[model samples]
Target: MFSYCTDPAALDGLAWFSCYLTTGKHMSIYYAVGTVLLLLAITAPLSLAFGFGGATAARSQILPLRWFGNTYIAIVRGVPDIAFFLFFVIALDQAFEYLRHRIKCPDWEAEVWQGNDFIVCAAAKLPLGNAPQWVHETYGFSLAVLTFAIVFGAFAANVLFGAMRAVPRGQIETAEAYGMTSRQTFWRVIVPQMWVYALPGLSNLWMVLIKATPLLFLLGVEDIVYWARELGGTKTPQFTDYPHGDWRMWYFLALLVFYLGFTKISEVVLDRIMARLTHGQAAAAGEAQRKAAA
Candidate 1:
């Protein structure tokens, strides 16, 4: 990044360190930080939307919809996260390719499953075989995002379902007494009240989601953890410019700091949200706030 970065061998002290930190690989580490944040930004709301749908479905009067919602929450929550992450990505990828293969290659002679290998026609390849590097990266990142949303959504659904149930039965009855339909009671009374109950669980889920960002490496997204390990490993002058000893401890330390700082910020934000949601309500938190104000 600097004119003097050209000759790393002669530089020493701060000069050498500056050059080392400005390398192409180091820039990638910086970019990976953004990648981690982007994953969280995209995944959080998508997961919440999924959770809302699942929770609503679980509460539906329709037997089949309720069964589906209950089964989805049960299966996802029961499975270990790592196991789900690994299994679901492959299954989803194959499902996509298989659909495309059937649609695009209807007349093709080759069986998709030949022995142990799963093959698809060239045209049906995700991002296509000859696509640019960015397209391939985008495809992988999209898959990672979807995987995260599905897994986290199930947990969120559980939290929301309990929250929905916690809304006072008296409130629902009062709404009905006022001639409100069930849908109107749910939308007007229950939905507003549920947030005060849901905030704590959702807050915890947010922290868990933040911590899970490292799993992006497993999904081939080149997230911060991946870059940290790659850049922190022992390097020799023989292999590349700007050689350094094993610095993984320091790199990982930075990651540790980043996560803690992010988590702290989230806690602050969630606390304020909780405060807002609880304001003017009859819940313990709201009562406490009222008492303190008085």
Candidate 2:
């Protein structure tokens, strides 16, 4: 980044370090951190929406609807999440490719699973065999994000489902007494009140989602972890213009700090939201606020 970094070999001390870190690969690593943030920004709302639908399904008045919703939430919780990430990405990908294969290569007579290999015509490939590098990365990243949304959505659903139940029965009863129908009671009385109770669990789930971002590396996305490992290592003359000793520990230390700061910030924000939600409620926090006001 600095003009003095022109000759990495000649540059010494901070100069060599600056040029080394500014290399294209290192720049990619830096950009990957932003990718992590982007994933979180996108996934949070998507997951919340998924969770809301799941919770609603579980509480639906219809028997089959309730069973389906409950089953979706229950099955996701029952399975190990890593297993789901691995299986679902591949399963969803293959399913996509299979459907494409069916249409694109109708004349081709090759089974998709021939023994251990998943053989499909090149025409059915996700980004196509000859597509640009960016498409492949985009495809992989999309799958990773989808996987994250699915897994975290399930956890959020469970939290929300409990939160919905936490809404006082009398609140619903009072709504009905006011001539509100079942749907009206749920939407106006239950839905609005549930957020306060759900905030704590949802906040915890948010922390978990933050921690889980690193797992994106396993999904083949070039996230911060990938960059930290790639660029943080000692460079030899053969590998780069600047040579250094082992520094992965320091790189990972940075990652730890990054995560800690992120989690702490999230905690502060959630706490503030909780306080706002508790402003006039009959919860403990609300009672404390009322006493302080008096």
Candidate 3:
């Protein structure tokens, strides 16, 4: 990383450490932390939105909608998350390319699938074959985000569906007696009350989501885990400015601490949010708060 790092053999001590951390590969690894956080920030809300929609659909009177929603929720719980991540990313990428192929090369005479290979026309390649490096990276990251959202959304749907059901039926009846339409009662009465019931489940889901971010490496994203392994491995002096013994344990230790800190902070925030959501409600948490106040 240092301009003085022109010759690896010439450097030693602090200069070597300085140059080692500043290397291009190491810099990219540092930036990969941001990639993980970005994935979390974007995926969290989108997943919740997907969950809410699925939960609503599951509760719908329409038979087909309920079936679809139930299927979505059931599939995730039944399947291992790693299996979904692996299968979905490949399937989704191919699905996109196939759609693009049909749209862009309708006249192509050859079949798109040859043996195990899924070959699409050059024009149908995602981000195009000649696209910039960043475009390819961005497209891959977007797919990863979508994959994470879909998988987690199903779990969230289950949690939210139960929360919706746990909202007392009396609340809905009371709203109906007050002349509220089904829509008004759902939004005003059921939705608001369900959060108090839902907070614990949602908080657990959030912590799981945080823990799952490391799986980004599986999706081919250069995430922190990938970097940790790469940078922590011993390198010969011929290949790097700073070469040393295996330090993977230390790097992983840092990751462990990072996650523990993140989850601890999340626990605090979720507790505050739960308290706010339960305020003045009829739930045990709310009752306890009122008792403390009295």
Candidate 4:
């Protein structure tokens, strides 16, 4: 912040705006942007991994494993995301504390569920009662990331399951005829060919995931939307310096620009990835690429 910021009232025009934008709270808004990006970066791959596992399990020859995978995908996909986020976070948090309580306070005799409230021993408090602010924030963030992964993973699993099936049966037969075991056939022929079919659905899922970042606000994470609404509200001089009228429209406009720009960049990247995956394959996309190259 500039030295002129010391007397915000005396400042005007660009000087006033510069100091206003550099305030501690404003810096928090900047950090919130990074928070959103970080959430996406961590959640995307985690969700994909979960999806891959679910899809693999769903396709397993073992009846119980297949049932488990199918049930997971069906239940998660059927539930509304907002309902899942709200319920799952509380349930998961309590589940963790319950396990810890059993281990750390086995001698304690108080009931965990008392009509309305869920309580655990002080020793079992996540991050402890005296942990630093950042630890609490990190714990909440981790929960949000897990919740996002689980929910999106279900959808991704469905996409991948269908993609896996779409791989030509003849390819698997050919691989097996070449002395490949079932595992070898899947790894060599099925896995490589499935991506071209999966990419379209996965790309749409990526876009949905990006849009869903705002739900972090509901999860108690101070994301960009939270900061935007807080900072954009009408700020009277009675409350603080550099007061401004309602500016939420401007704040949200910036968010719109950010999301649009980010998704546009994602589209370009996904297209390139799709091109790479399709290269030299037998799919229609591969045929088109070959024609274009020729």
lDDT of 1 by residue, 100-172 (tens): 9999999999889999899999999897989999999999999999999999999999999999999989989
Candidates, ranked, lDDT: 4, 1, 3, 2
lDDT of 2 at 231: 72
Clashing pairs in 3: none
Misplaced by over 4 Å in model 3 are 1-15
Better by TM-score, candidate 2 or 1: 1
Clashes of each: 0, 0, 0, 0
TM-score of each model, in listed order:
0.98, 0.95, 0.95, 0.98
Ranking 1 against 3 by lDDT, winner: 1
Tell me the deviation in Å of residue 13 in model 4.
1.1
Per-residue error at 58 for model 1, in Å?
A: 0.6
Q: Model 3: which ten-residue window has the lowest total lDDT? A: 234-243
**Which is the winner by TM-score between candidate 1 and candidate 3?**
1
What local distance difference test score does each model get? 0.93, 0.88, 0.90, 0.95
Candidate 3 global CA lDDT score:
0.90
Question: Over the stretch 66-93, how does candidate 3's per-residue lDDT look in tens digits?
Answer: 9999999998779999999999899999
For candidate 3, what is the TM-score?
0.95
Candidate 3's displacement at residue 199, Å, is: 1.1
